[model samples]
Target: MLQQVSFPLRTECPPGACVCERERLLAEPDADLRPLRLTRMEEQKLIDRIEGIASYEELKRLQDRIRTNLGVELKITPSPNEVRTLRGIVILLEDRPGLCKKVRQSIPAAVRKALERHPEITYAILDANDLFGM
Candidate 1:
């Protein structure tokens, strides 16, 4: 079983000293720790939610939302320089079972618009089914 305990606050650092701290903390060791535990009912609820994600667009929205929830800086715009190089933010939404698209050709113009805006997007496979390929 999990338990909670409390301790008194203690700090030696001076005020106004932790500016730009996110970068420093990120750079520090073992910052990638996010603990998660789920009860049986919660696990079943999560399974149901995953099963209910119906469409590609819904998947994208969910992914973007999760990033927002996690305080991640998202890059919705991808560059258009695939021939030269591949770089930029690429958010993949989901891998629906038995659904796949190899190229961005089949993607709607609405989705392609992000890639067209910036020439700096070196390469974007941007497969709709590939979640957060970055």
Candidate 2:
């Protein structure tokens, strides 16, 4: 007979620290789940990419690149007023399933192009959100 399995959220680790408890559980003979972990350098790269951006136009360019290269519908909604700071480019995209994979696949190239197109852009951040009220 098949049994239902549930994983618990670990609260002991610090806010951004990586956890591998799920992996440990999966290693069990009867466990039915898999866990994923990213190396420290990989995590740092993600933080740098998201935090290094500097302008809305750069964000738009990245979004356009993703749409063109990945065939993903990425919409960027910039704030009405422009605030110039080192905060970089921040964008909100509809969080449909599988969209993240497309964004991930396209980002490296898109970022490279954005850098070449706009020297002012230092970083870009793409955040996903649920658009459907469901």
* Candidate with best TM-score: 2
- Worst 10 contiguous positions by lDDT, candidate 1: 97-106
Clashing pairs in 1: 79-121, 85-122, 86-123, 92-130, 92-131, 92-132
TM-score of each: 0.26, 0.27
For model 2, give the 10-residue run with minimal summed lDDT.
124-133
What TM-score does prediction 2 earn? 0.27
lDDT per residue as tens, model 2, 1-134? 33234533222234334333443443465642311222234434544553455675646664565455334444443234543432333333444322333333344444444444554443232222222225
Question: Model 1 off-target regions past 4 Å?
Answer: 1-34, 65-134
State the displacement of the C-alpha of residue 48, model 2, in Å, after optimal TM-score superposition.
Answer: 3.6
Tell me the lDDT of candidate 2. 0.40
Cα lDDT tens digits, model 1, 61-85, are: 7446534532332234344433332
